[model samples]
Target: MADDMTDNMLILSMISQVFALILRSSFLSGGLGDA
Candidate 1:
């Protein structure tokens, strides 16, 4: 049970990080394009 919880937390953390990275990149690209 503990192992399963840890795995789930890790997966969630990875997904959140990926989402943040995508958002940051998109914002940067848009700013660069405007300039």
Candidate 2:
């Protein structure tokens, strides 16, 4: 149970980081990475 929660949190954290990077890059470059 506790382990499940930890794993979920870790996954969420990584996803959030990736999402944030995409958002930031898109905003700065004015492109949604659809080169």
Candidate 3:
């Protein structure tokens, strides 16, 4: 049970990282385009 919980947490962390990167990239592109 503990192992399963740890796995779930790890997956969630990875997903959050990917989402943050995507958001950051889009913001950068939009800002550059405006300039």
Candidate 4:
């Protein structure tokens, strides 16, 4: 049970990281395009 919980937490963390990265890049691209 503990192992399963840990795996789920890891997956969540990875997904969050990917989402953050996408947001960051999109913001940067948008700013550059505006200028």
Model 2 off-target regions past 4 Å?
31-35
Question: Model 1: what TM-score?
Answer: 0.79
**Candidate 3: lDDT of 30?**
88
Which stretches in model 1 have alpha-carbon errors above 4 Å?
31-35
Q: What RMSD value applies to candidate 1?
A: 3.9
Candidate 3 clashes between residue pairs 3 or more apart in a chain or in different chains: none
lDDT of 3 by residue, 1-35 (tens): 99999999999999999989887887888854653
TM-score of each: 0.79, 0.81, 0.82, 0.82
lDDT of 2 at 20: 96
The TM-score-based order of candidates, best leading, equals 3, 4, 2, 1
Question: How many times do residue backbones clash in model 1?
Answer: 0
> What is the clash count for each candidate, in the order shown?
0, 0, 0, 0
Model 3, residue 21: distance off in Å is: 0.2
- Show the colliding residue pairs in model 1: none
lDDT, residue 35, model 2: 37
For model 3, the run of ten residues with the poorest summed lDDT: 26-35
lDDT of predicted model 1: 0.88
Candidate 2 lDDT trough over 10 residues, lowest sum: 26-35
In lDDT terms, which candidate is top? 2
Give Cα-based local distance difference scores for all models: 0.88, 0.90, 0.87, 0.87
lDDT of 2 by residue, 1-35 (tens): 99999999999999999999988888888787653
